[model samples]
Target: MLINLSKLLSGDQETITEQVTLEMEAFVSSIGTFPVVEKRSFPLKVSKIGADKFLIEGETAVTLDIPCDRCLTPVKVEIPLNISREYDKNTVEEEAEDENLIVGYNLDAEQLIYCEILVNWPMKTLCTEACKGICKKCGANLNHSSCTCDTVELDPRMAKIRDIFNNAK
Candidate 1:
């Protein structure tokens, strides 16, 4: 969804509010792609703040299927988007950030929402706080069952001593 800002830039209109529909089925980035399972339409507002400057604001929510960091299990993560950005024609500060939501006099609503979601993505996701994670040695989910792999962890400083004992066999 693209919103024309020519009227607002010309000062013929002080503000423009439109109910924009999100047309993204998934969010793609360098990390990975997450499916957008749900979304809702919301009103986006663009208002003139200064000469050749404007403010874009909107609120919407979307649910994504993000995997758990420790267990690799898919979890439903609802990301609430309270999008706000400043469009400037004088400097390239936004371009440096790769915001690229605004090009010339057109605002990319989909890109704006995508950027907001990327900024607010969770750093860590877990199925539960007490999740036991997976058995690294056997590749089994510890939360569901136990594994027979050695649980002892030896310090690196004692590796040479353990190697000497093994040579005796």
Candidate 2:
């Protein structure tokens, strides 16, 4: 969605409000396609802060299917989005990062949404808080079934410590 900020820049209105839905299936880093189920809607509001500066704020909700960090199971996760960006049509700041400062009369809503998604996404996604995780012995998903493997493998670097304890006994 390309937001034409001409009116807001011209002082035609103090603020402009619009609702938009993003339906693109874009590949995300670490996570697969975002909003694996449906489109995401954003309720955005843009206000004139100065002669050429504007403030944009919005909220969007998105559901994504991501692999659980522990069990590697595909889990449905709902992410809440809250975004705010400052824009200056006249000033171009090279140090300003994306979403923090936008220049020009046209605002790229899709890019803004992508930025919010990245900011809100967690580093790890788990099906449950107490997931058992997969078994390292047989590569079995511990969350689904139990494994009979001894599962007591120790690091080779700690062999000296184990031998010292054994000799003490």
Candidate 3:
């Protein structure tokens, strides 16, 4: 959704509130793509702070299906986003921040939301804290069922003694 900032920038309106619907089904980034399960229509406030400067603000929550780090199970993770950013029209292209969010004189609502989601993305996602994860040997889901892999730990210092006993046997 693109919002025209002409009125706000033209001094006709000092501030304006525009409601934009988030129409993204998935978020594609450099890391990977995550499916967006839920989002809501929200209003964004655009204010002309000074000459050629504008401030945009809003709040919303987005839920996404992110795979767990340990078990790789898809988990619905809700990420809350607070959008508050200022744009300067006279900024240089190389130095400008969020330059892609501005298309001509219109503000890109979807792009703004994307930036927010990207910044607030969790470093690690888990289905549960006690998730047993997958088996290292047979690649079985430990949380669902146990495997018949080795279940013993021997101290390295006693390895020689244990090996001697094994040869005697």
Task: Report how far off residue 97 is in candidate 1 (Å).
Answer: 4.7
**Which residue pairs overlap in candidate 3's backbone?**
none
Give the number of the best model, judged by TM-score.
1
On a 0 to 100 scale, what is the lDDT of residue 121 in model 3?
93
Off by over 4 Å in 3: 92-97, 152-169
Residue pairs of candidate 1 with colliding backbone atoms:
none
Give per-candidate clash totals: 0, 0, 0
Which candidate tops lDDT?
3
Assess candidate 3 and give its lDDT: 0.86
Candidate 3 residue-wise lDDT, 26-143, digit = tens: 9888778899999998899999998978888999999999988898899999999888888776673763336777767798888889888988999889999999888888998889
Cα error of candidate 1 at position 109, Å:
0.6
Better of 2 and 3 by TM-score: 3
Tens-digit per-residue lDDT, 61-161, candidate 1: 99899988898888889999887878675764644543576787888888888888988998888989888889888899988998877666677769878
Which lDDT values do the candidates have, in the order given? 0.85, 0.74, 0.86
Ordering by TM-score? 1, 3, 2
